[model samples]
Target chain A: MTTHDLEYDNPNAIEAHNMSVYYGSFRAVKDVSLAIEKNRITALIGPSGCGKSTVLRSFNRMNDLVPSARVEGQVLFHGENIYAPGVDPVNVRRRIGMVFQKPNPFPKSIYENVIYGPRINGWKLSRREMDELVERSLRGAALWDEVKDKLNQNGLSLSGGQQQRLCIARALAVEPEVILMDEPCSALDPISTLKIEELMFELRQHYTIIIVTHNMQQASRASDYTAFFLMDSDRTGQLVEYGSTSQIFQNPKDERTEQYISGQFG
Target chain B: MAVTELRRQPSLLRAAFERFIQVLLVFAAAISILTTAGIVFSLVFETIAFFSEVSIVEFLTETEWTPLFSIKKYGIWPLVTATVLTSAIAMMVAVPLGLIAAIFLSEFASDNIRRTVKPLLEILAGIPTVVYGYFALTTITPFLKNFIPTLSIFNSLSAGLVMGVMLIPFVASLSEDALSAVPNSLREAAYGLGSTRFEVAVRVITPAAISGIVASIVLAFSRAIGETMIVAIAAGQNPRLTFDPTVPVMTMTSYIVQVSLGDTPYGSLSYYTLYAVGFTLFIFTFILNIFSYWMVRKFREVYD
Candidate 1:
């Protein structure tokens, strides 16, 4: 299958060209082609184990960490193929950052966690520069006011909601062009989830945000674009429908998407 | 009615059986505690008897340890110094190599490679310490003699090096387990932030697993301190105050081995020295293990 180049009114920030992600012989996501536009929140919504996370992980080539996992098609970032020969996964990831399902702050201080990305990538900032960056990133994630007094405290010391926000701050510190979130709010409480949803809306002004979520309401509530995925007969996940959130919610083209969103079937 | 009663409560017979099982388990747990207590009791009285014959101040302050020699010096320093020198050498050899092996096993190796290689590393641990003693005496001693300027035939250097080889599995296996235990999410987060494999493994993964790795190394060092065969064979039984690894020096274990091998009269002063040395060895290792426990507690990142 080839990538479907639809008449997208918005220019593409990233294009997944018939990407079939596999683990050894088993295909997890089969021939998934998606175009995520710049400055927009695109939600990959589906039932559990539908390979939405796999599709999201492929954006940063995180699936490369799994020895058996392989990607068969091109994932183009700003028109450059990420999986092409000689392309650095580190460089690809620097351009496109990710937030995991659970809040995974590094086992370090809050200040250190925010600056970890820049530090590893050889950004030799002065003490003042580091302090400012830490503040800016924390503020960017909407956690600075709550945690400014305790920047030296361990990242894991934060509440679950705060930890998730800290992870967002850590990802934001690198100044990534695209942010991929895999169920970033799945482990958060309702208030925290709402806060994160608000942060996503604000973040859409700067980053091309792609989020994988099992929550139907999160997709309908937060994302501008919603892509519904369903398991095929063979159990490999495939894209069922893609459209504006309002259209997908009100008038889903596929019956499966309607069934899934209406809680009729999963 | 019987089914409903059974669901509501366990039968008296079954309850009594469960209590019997719990008592059996508790008795099993108490056996090790009793053994430890017994060993301590045996060591304490003999140690007290040895100390009564030789003053504690003289045992500590004096630099020489030649109670069996014509001169009859009785300093613990000679044996203590030898133990320190050899154990330090063992740590030097084991720490870097073992940690690197752990890092390789945990972070770099493919799953197939890990499955085969991890057991091979454990095989190093499985090899008897007596075999290590022979390897130290014959192979390491001769090999060092060829290269080192002042390396001796029966020296602590060979014993320490070979003992370190024996201990590599302990450090590597535990550390690898620790590194692997660090949730995949942590690694993913590091990678997602553009960390290279080296960066992720060292800077991120290592920090997260430092307590476990440090505990492994410390336990390996303690094992090195207590090791008998390699030190006894390769490191000679001659007690010397010199700190040099190339010289023949008697460790506490080796001295005890030398005495136990010879038929010294029962309850003699020489026989009493074995208990005294054993007590010292016990104290040192006990302190070391306790310190390790404290350090592990101090450094634990508490990821969960």
Candidate 2:
């Protein structure tokens, strides 16, 4: 892949054009168009049900799980249309990893949970290689030092913070290009949330990340770019502003964004 | 201040009513326990009285079981063996079918399909066992006779087969509950990792709920062992130790029914045989119930 082929001028990892999501007859996200940069943390901050999480799920087609949900227009990843016919949703999901709001570890040992993604994808690594990968992934999530001696223990035996880190490691084990985190620190204490924010800074060097959060300070602290979404008069979510975090918080282009950051309204 | 002074006195009648309700609730719970204890105590005492006259060795070792004949040979093995054989066959049939149905309902069925199928399954459980006995005698026996020419009109094979069908809903309903109780997040986590739906169900959900599944199987086994009307009506009351389902074999339950219906002389060996058989059946089912309860209690749910 040459520099020209990769196109660093517009190094957009994800490009959404006129994408709208509907559940039954009610539209949740209306004509949202945004370009997420590669190798940067983009924070999606909005009030609850503002379609931030909905847009995050749309990236990996996770919304397909909802029986009544439907998506229109285009979502492109690496210049390829993810929702095109003949494109496998499973393959799309494998390339784009996700960590839910709550930590969800399988009812298995820590070792098993970390290796689950690679093992399912038929990555035939030797036992030693598998162990090294597990350790590497755990270290990448900033959890290896805490759980090095208890790899054989059940994943559920860990504290809430440790479990969330384990889930991050699980997502990392697959070697995905992009990671989507839906309020990954919402359930954690302030100290653990700080730790996760630091981990996210470290992770941005290798993988493009999109995080949905309600905490404005977290978005300002950890993200390079921020997208502000707001509910319209009709109760549907619409993007208000998208720019560098410094610009969005310090000098917002939209008045709605200013009011939102100034705590006048959601 | 004046209104508060007037309301300061608590109503004695209201307090007494609350106390009365609490006492009644406690009394109801105690009655449940007392009823179980009474039945167990009566069964034990009567069983002891029966065992005094008949040697334990004779009851256990003898193969021929003819309590009413002029030359009585009282051996419980033939009846016990019959019960085991039929239950084993019934379990072999029920476990696989029930588990598959449960997996389908819990994992694969659409919401609409499940709504229709689950109640239809429970209807099978709701059917009276006597109706199953009649169905076995009339339909299943004749059906089996077409394949196996040697099948007796009243044989353990047909009875056990129909009994297995009757037990299907019991196993399926409980196993479905176990499978449904497995958190949706677990399945989503597996899917997010690129696991196929089958892989998630087989690898994650099944193992997560293994204890509950095992408990359901054990409970179904107990139901099969304790079933009476199906075997009594379809399986002839002749206690003979034979593996061939073509021949008439008597179960412990069937023998109890036979002896009770015949009006055997009071205080005679035949009269005492009922208690002996009842005791053995009780012990067998009690052990199974305990094992099932233990397996369910031992299960640990994973939540993060």
Candidate 3:
């Protein structure tokens, strides 16, 4: 479906209704409900351990990796329930790609990393077609010119920023409709962060993007919408406010959002 | 600044104690190095003495190995060929079974199942090689002779098969560690792309850890070649060059045992032959160990 239709119908690429994440007896995220818009960079901004990453991971069931983790809620993607029984998590992941905070490039050449997804999914293209796809994906991540000549070089040989971008390229090569980035530029330098921010802007044109970040400036600079999540006195995160970037930064509906934005508290 | 602190010059006693500890550590390391060097030197010295009496060309090229015979013909080929044939059979049995066990332990088995199965498998390794030798001689050989009429009571087949079982744990444990060292992220990435678990393990994980797997195989092969007790007890002490498993054969270790147990004079060329055999076995294992280590390091995945 088109982004316009998604906006008119739901204004969200994904919606979590009354979501709660628990690690055994400990509740990490409590009663969090938020809607992320399609074709817009929706930044989940919060301090560390505020359950922002947990909620982001729940989108593609990445939290399932932790044996103790348990989730209760409806995570809707393209108006379909992702957490429903019989809905294959692998298929869900194929449609929704993830870029981790730290650059976790596969121990392989750049060309191999980018084409890994397509190759696994049985994309039987000729060598020329595969090469073209690799170039296109790298260009989409704004990493083409820098690595065009070094496709055969190891992915680990790239600089921190370049590796993160290569990871993004790897994710994009699978042709996912949504991309989930967890602090994509936190480990990078300022110049690399700016490059990533610019790439995020470009990415939103094609893919629905949801990013979790601790950098408020990055939320303001890169995101069209901002979600402010906060932990209460019990250290359980709950959604405080989510709205257009202008409204959240200019005049938040919640006082906590204002306090956080004004640097009164984190 | 107001109070003047009085400090003794660096205590000679403390300095001496620290030096003592350093000396102890250096001595410990030196002992290990020296032990290996001494063994090699002794083996080489005795082997060279034996070769003086028995020409090097005769030892390597002669096909018949009858050192204790009236004619005293000495050929190394029979012993070398027997060792290779037995080792080959042992590896053939060990490699596939060990790899499957490793896959099951690392990939398929549940935590509870692994906890129970791993130690049990290790028990096989812990059984003294002599016990395996006796079992192979009394039980396995008798059982095999019933099925295959041509099987000798003291055949290499039964001994090699039992030796393979003994070596399984080494191969399995090392391979399991190698497989487990593969990052979960790679597996997750593969799964995220719709690859099956089998596909992820076989195609990605195995290739990624190819070096470790190769090293484990080399180590298992070395273990097979150096194995002694089982072959000595079950396989006949006949150093005849033959590829037939149903026939009796002798490995290098078995030949040394046979010569040592016999009434050969200590200073005779026959007695020194033990050192020559020992030196050959030592060099073989040493080269394999070095190659395996190199392979493991060369393919190691260095993560930032």
Candidate 4:
């Protein structure tokens, strides 16, 4: 799969062209080719050890932090290969933000946590503009009403649900065009998970979202499209199926996808 | 029941051996405790004898400390001021240099480089302090004299600077451990938000591990206060309450060392001052350890 293949009337926010990731000599994810549509939620679903999270991390070049991890193919954003020579991973990550499975808000005040991304990215704003950015970001993440009274409080002081929302607000403050969430709701309660799902629906009007999750119900409920992955005999994760959520859930073409969706085996 | 039969058939010899091992461990632990208690008791006993002759008010308020001379005046301020001055100079050199090395080791160094360099860096701490004292006297003092002609042969400047080099490994190793203990999730979060490695390190990781970093600093400062050989050998035995690093002055530890090695008769006033100075050093280090513990408990960021 090449960038030209996906450059049609509807543009993709990001596309991975036969991307394979290796940790030292061990291949973790093998030849994953997918086009992430703009302004829609795409869920990467698989069992544990299938490297769905690894694939998601590679999209923003977060795997570059791991000294041994290496990417072999191209990740294209806005028709340019992000892995091309001289393409700075810092700038790549600036346009593509990420949220983790754990709500890792910095050990700072809630307002500081929201502004951290912008601050590091060197967005020089006036005090009032900073305040407005914080308010807007919090509102975008559906957390302003709960935390507006105590923006000075430490981010870790919030409940697990509120902390996850604060992380989302922090990610949103960067004004990223794409957000990669690696099981962002896996650590939250069901109510918090529902809030995140609804927030995803609202965010689909603006930014593209690619999420990796083990929850089959969540993939069906929250995402418009779903990509299912499975580990091969060599224990490398490969995409088994990719389609609209309804097609993947109701009438999966691959027998393995059906087996996985029906919980026969993972 | 089978459970009752198994309990009834339990091996008495193995149980006896387990109890014996437990008793041996208890004795081993008790020996160290008893040794510490004995030392503290002797220090307190002699310190009391010394204070009976010299009033605590005079010991503290008097500026001159010349217990060895014929016209003896007992003042602890001179030794205390010299100790503080040397330790302050040592900290000024150690803190920035050690912290930068720690950040490099923890945040920037590759796995191969860090593994190869960290142990080599730790070897600096393993070198004998007596050697460091001589290095300060012979090498650093002469080298520094080329730049600052006012430097004395036995100046606190060289002694404190060499002590700082000796303390670098202590600060760097402990601080690296603290910085490395910060969960990778925080680093990932920072980098995910477009932060460069330097920004992530200085902003997120350092602040997260600040309690441990501060505890390392406190422990390093405590070591500096209790340091004996470096100051005793390179810093001269002149008990002058001066802040000038270029001048020769005696610290509390050095004064105690001087009295211990010299022909100060047993049970004399000068001999008893050894216990007083030792007690002071003990108290200073103990307070710093307690403060480090408190800071660790109070400011630690508990990440789940």
Candidate 5:
């Protein structure tokens, strides 16, 4: 696909335009627009119930799994609106993979877990090619050294941190251009959290990563760009500020953003 | 001195009431255990008397089962084989039908459809077994005869098929429960990886819920083995060693029912044979229950 929009020199990985998400009649996320750049780590930071995760889910159309959830406006990926008629959510999810807050690995062997994405997409790879793919994916997630000896063990047998990385590897196997993470390190310990932050730095060279985090230090430490969200008077979440991480953290743009970042109130 | 003064003594009336309730609860629990023990005692006693009259070797080895006739061959294989054959046929009908229905209910059916249809499906189980017997004899047998012209009027095929219909609720409801008990995280994980609903259900949910599914099947098999009225009314009382579903056969439960019709004299070898057959049926069901328990314990996956 040719780049039609000139908003960024690097070409935006994903852009949301007047996107609003509703659960039945209750609006969860108000119209909020943001452009995520290619090959950068963008952290969405806010208190609980800010709809940051909601926007993250909308990026890959993960919210479609919920029976009551509905989307309006547009979530543009490679200049194509994902929510357009005849655009299948299944194909959208394949092109933009996700990792959840909690580590979720299939109840299968580690080898099988890595290959599951490719297998479901109907890849016809031989045994040797399959092994190579597993190794490459695991190494990309920086989990190969610890889990390579036990590829046949169940993925659930791994530690919580390892499982999250395994999920990342599983996402990487399908070769997606963008990866969405919803509080991926919230359940992890500080050490595991640090490892994930370091891995994000390593992965930023190849894949565009958008993360929703509740941890302030993590957003400041790990992300190149930061978007701050807060609940409106009606409790519908709206984006308050979006800028470079240094600017959003240190400089004042909005009084609410300053109050939220400096710990005056959530 | 301060501690002793601050302490309050327990009330005797409330303590006595609590003791009474505990005793009542223990008695209620013991009643069920005592009843099972009582049944085992009688079956064993009568079975011992039966073995005294007929040698264990003859009971195990001989092919025919005619304790009432003058020639009187006291073999058990005919009844055993008949029971196994009918149960196998019933499984053939029930397993696929029940599992497919379970998959649809758990994975495909909308909530409204599931809520409305599950009770209707369970109503099949609520139908009395005697009614199923009559339906097999009056309806299914005549229906099958049109296709298999040589089909017997009193055949195991009709009885087994009707019994399988009676058993669908047991398998479907339990299997559905197992499938639904799988965590939503697993489903989300699969869908996020780009799996279709079919792939998510078959490859992930089914395998994850396999232990419970196997347990359900085993329990349903045990229930089918112990079912009597359908086999007695439709499958006939001809005890013969055969696997042929088109022929007349008798299960162990049906044999027990046959003797309990009150024609045989009390304390006769033929009368004692009822308890022996009941004991055999009890053993089969008991083994199945233990196997199901072991299967669940061995393969159950705990999701967090």
Candidate 6:
């Protein structure tokens, strides 16, 4: 009954199978399933509080930090159930990184911020190796040139967009297989948002990217395919449409999808 | 309406009333400054008088502190050493336990458990210091005496331990506030990087909250150094020149109290010694406060 029920071929990076997320007793995200293709950008576009962020967080088991949050079904990564017993959420997160809505750089030096993940994972590197990793990660996020001279400066001292990129660089240092961005550019200016969009396209060659955004234009422009989420009768997020960006934006199968894409109602 | 309001000048009475309110507020703010100035002036004046009789060199370098007894050796080291020893012990107890308790309360405990437990922890700080003094004197010293044969009835160990107990809730409560003030986004970033709970709390959150935590510890240490009741009740009256916590030792506060309780003639050298010691205590605590301020100013990483 839901678009989330649709299936994809093999070689998918992440697969949420009949997953439902609940906050306390309320079903915040209804029974919905979706397959995220490998090395492709999948944008979850929806209105405010449509559970896009919630469903995205469930993939890496970040929702486990919430005491009352419970997942009813499975989130599979590379054919292994992430939510299954004895599968550590910490290990799950090691394979899948996340970026937040706002620019949340740790109040540390730029150099320290990038190395924090690698250090905790017990990767002992030489001074030269560390410098290279920092450079590579910063370059990966397209932030190396702006911040090369002062690696010792606080990460929070950067501009809003640069801080977000530093967060992206920090995530990249961990070298996760999939990167989940929860409205990464919502707080950014248009130019910075474009920069992040461009960076996403570049990042798609290496990591599987899943982003939740409210901007219709951003979804169509930045993603290869988009999943449109809307509230159901019970006010829980239900997938209404799923297709390629050009197909959903140009021609829609459902009236609701048409109304949403045409800017009638979000 | 804006032009009319801008064009009009205040009436004489209204202007005078505003001036009066401003002066009143300024006077209210100046009360603290005036009090500090008064205390400083009085302490310095008497400390100079005490120096007239007892040399500054002897006060700093001499090991004896028998101003009340027959020997009358005026070295200030015994009192200073005793105060430092007790405060060090207090810090040793308060730092690890209080910080762990804070981390537990902020990062580990659930909402229900936190709601039920944090208030109970704070209640420990609310208990009067006099009761702690008695608890140290009547109960703790006796319990400790069973283990250590050389433990005196009035020893620094019991007093310092009880002082640490009293300061536990202080350090824990303040540090919990600092640790929790770290934005959840930072924790998320760490978690997203595959950091375990312990790693996130220790490596990420602790470093972020370091300034505030150090501030709490320094403030608690200042409180410990200035504490009187527990030291006076349990840590004996004689100022001795040894680092041994088992033996009875006197602190600067205890000396001041001992002198103030008995009859010391006004305008005498004995009376001036009180101010001298009080001034020394004041200087130590002032340095600690300044250090705390500098640490917070220099190292604080502001997260918005």
Candidate 2 local lDDT, residue A131: 98
Q: Please provide, for model 6 over A150-204, each residue's C-alpha lDDT reduced to its tens digit, 9 standing for 90 to 100.
A: 9999998999999999999999998998999999999999999999999999999
Instruction: Give candidate 6's error at residue A19 in angstroms.
Output: 1.7
Lowest lDDT block of 10, candidate 6 chain A: A1-10
In model 3, which residue pairs have backbone atoms overlapping below 3 Å?
Answer: none
Q: TM-score for every candidate vs. truth?
A: 0.94, 0.94, 0.92, 0.95, 0.96, 0.94
Put down candidate 5 lDDT per residue, B84-107, tens digits, no spaces: 888888888888899999999999
DockQ, candidate 1, comes to 0.84
Q: List-wise, what DockQ does each model earn?
A: 0.84, 0.71, 0.47, 0.88, 0.79, 0.79
What DockQ class does candidate 6 belong to?
medium
Candidate 2, after superposition: displacement of residue B22 in Å? 2.9
lDDT (C-alpha) at residue B81 in model 6: 89
Per-residue alpha-carbon lDDT of model 6 for B80-105, expressed as tens digits? Answer: 98999888888888988999999999
Worst 10 residues of 3 chain B by lDDT: B1-10
Q: Give a tens-digit lDDT track for model 3, residues B93-175.
A: 88989988988898778788889988988888899999999999999999998899999989889998998888888888888
CAPRI tier of model 2: medium
For the predicted complex of model 2, DockQ is 0.71
lDDT of 4 by residue, A1-266 (tens): 77546665556898899999999999999999999999999999989999999999999999998889999988888788888999899998999999999999999999999999999988999999999999999999999999999999999999998999999999999999999999999999999999999999998898999999989999999999999999999999999999999999999999999999999987
Model 6 pairs whose backbones collide: none
In every candidate, what fraction of the native interface contacts is reproduced? 0.98, 0.62, 0.38, 0.98, 0.71, 0.87
Superposition TM-score, candidate 2 onto the true structure:
0.94
lDDT score, residue A200, model 3? 90
Q: What's the distance in Å from true for residue A183, model 1?
A: 0.9
Model number with the top TM-score: 5
lDDT of 1 by residue, A136-225 (tens): 999989999999999999999999999999999999999998999999999999999999999998889899999999899999999999
How well does candidate 1 score on lDDT at residue A19? 94
Interface RMSD of 2: 0.9
